[model samples]
Target: MKTLQKITVILTIGLALSILVVFFTTSNAVSSGNETIIRFGHGAAESNERHLAVMKFKELVEEKSEGKMKVQVYPNEQLGSEAEMIESVTFNDLQMVAASAFSQYDQRISVFELPYLFDTYEQAWQVLDGEIGQEVAEPLLEDGLRVVAYFENGFRHVTSNKPIEEPEDLSGLKIRTPEFPLSISTFKAFGSNPTPMAFGELYMALQQGTVDAQENPIANTYASKFNEIQDYLSLTAHQYMPLPVAISEEFWRTLTSEEQEIIKSSASEAAQFHRDILRENEEEMISKLQDAGMTVIEPDRDKFREEADAVYEAYKNRFGEDFVNNILKAVK
Candidate 1:
């Protein structure tokens, strides 16, 4: 009886040890094989469509990877302004950023900001999704950033306290613009004094009359409720703002080819979803702005186009006439 009891105790001890070994091994495997976390940052308001698209990207990546890859988004400049965020991504301090191309104007990516460059969104997409887009992406590689996709930033329009029936209406008005030189020049061509300001401070600036007007997409104008302080919505559609979805090249190169492919595919898929949503909701955004008591003005588009020519002439030499001509040819 004594021998049998000893045998039973030994067996029980062995079983407990086996269970602990299995648990430890499984835990180590999970910890080692866990998906990498990518941090994405942007400077748009939480209520903006761009923010919503970021959320969608988060969901899509996680679902496609079965949670093996995760996207964490920082909105409302939680990271910094667009230019700062781009610098962060370039240094690998941040994994990803969705920033307006205008912020990189000094880098020559702002060539896209030339007025009336895109007659239609489709034409813009073809240029962005093709060889020209690849060429533009090449210059950014030196900054340690890789372009994943081009997300729609929609067309830009002017919002001011006074009505803008033509370029004359913008004369002497102080307008707030992004930090891009092209944007400043474009406003200048229209006879307005452009002031560069951060997106966060724009509302207060308008309220305090620090700047009399600003330009942004209908969605942004409505989402920020800029319509409240501003009286007229001039549909300038001067520039097609393309939000470049970029990843740190250092981080991207560290991934296995398979992992890189996964992320690129997921980003492309999410970008299309974003564009579809924007197009569907554009009309609704117009309606909402009208309901919010903002007067929407459809100006003589041709006049606006002609005024934009001055901007092209001024910057073409700097951007390389070949690059400019190629882009224009691609779009045409």
Candidate 2:
């Protein structure tokens, strides 16, 4: 009888533990009969600031909406490339994406990608958070994407097999640039034979000598482990790229205005979180890149800036000269 009782006690304890496990596991979920699921995707790794901020958005949304809106965050292109994910959003296959190349949806946005557009981070934020931001995002809204907030990609710098101290230094070097036309034109103006390539193909392309060099923000370069293959990290600060936290307009229209406000505020707060973390860790990222044996070269930015003027002129012709001048005036 004692043995049978002991078995009964063990079974009872096991059942109780399982009950607790279920409760704890789902404790954060919305306790509602009807719940809305939001799928948020990005191309950054889990360790990236982008991922962390995205998780914070998940936390805030679930907590604020009391489990009414459940956010599913997918990092490292689990959904697909930024472009593919965005296309998915348009069709409602996906709900959201943190993508840097929103310019693809509207070519006018590419003007902001012009090199040295904003001299510092503060000035960039000032312009983006103000009227210019609405102007940039308005085009996307018409195209089925609603931008919540502008996330950071930081300032882009060049990484290569040789030291790049000036525009002439990049001469004849075939550098991998994003397939974006503005990027291709900018690098062309810089004297590089710019090869349009996908970001996913870059590492192997570098290792196999398919491309001589590529450029990215220091954090992304380090996170992607490009430092292992590249020799010099020239601080070009050529372009300031911002990842837009965007949602499907179709999905957005389904939400109540209150739910929309919740998601919007959470997105804005999360973007601020990424900005703070990026600013805090930039110095450490540069040090780690150096420790890993990549030489960090601070190039004469003025020379690069001067070369970028040709890109601006190209934009003026591509876009209207008046529109380009208005953008230039806004930053001032």
TM-score of each: 0.87, 0.88
How many Å off is the CA of 170 in candidate 2?
A: 0.5
Query: Each candidate's lDDT (Cα)?
Result: 0.83, 0.87
- Candidate 2: deviation at residue 283, Å? 0.7
Q: Poorest 10 consecutive residues of model 2 by lDDT?
A: 24-33
lDDT of 2: 0.87
Position 325, candidate 1: lDDT: 88
Which candidate ranks first by lDDT, i.e. highest? 2
lDDT of 2 by residue, 1-332 (tens): 99999999999999999988765433222223588888888998898899999999999999999988889888999877888898878876788889877777788877778899988888888877888887878889887898888888878889999999999999999999888887788899999999988888999999999999998887889888999899999999999887788888888888899999999999988988988899889999999999999999998999998988888887898888998898899999
**lDDT tens readout by residue for model 1, 1-332:** 99999999999999999998866432122223577678888987787778888888888778877888877789988977787888878877788889885345345666677899988888888888888887887878877889988888878989998888888888999999988888889999989899998887899999999999999887788778897898889888988888889998888887778778877887787788878888889889888888889898988889888888888888878888887888888888
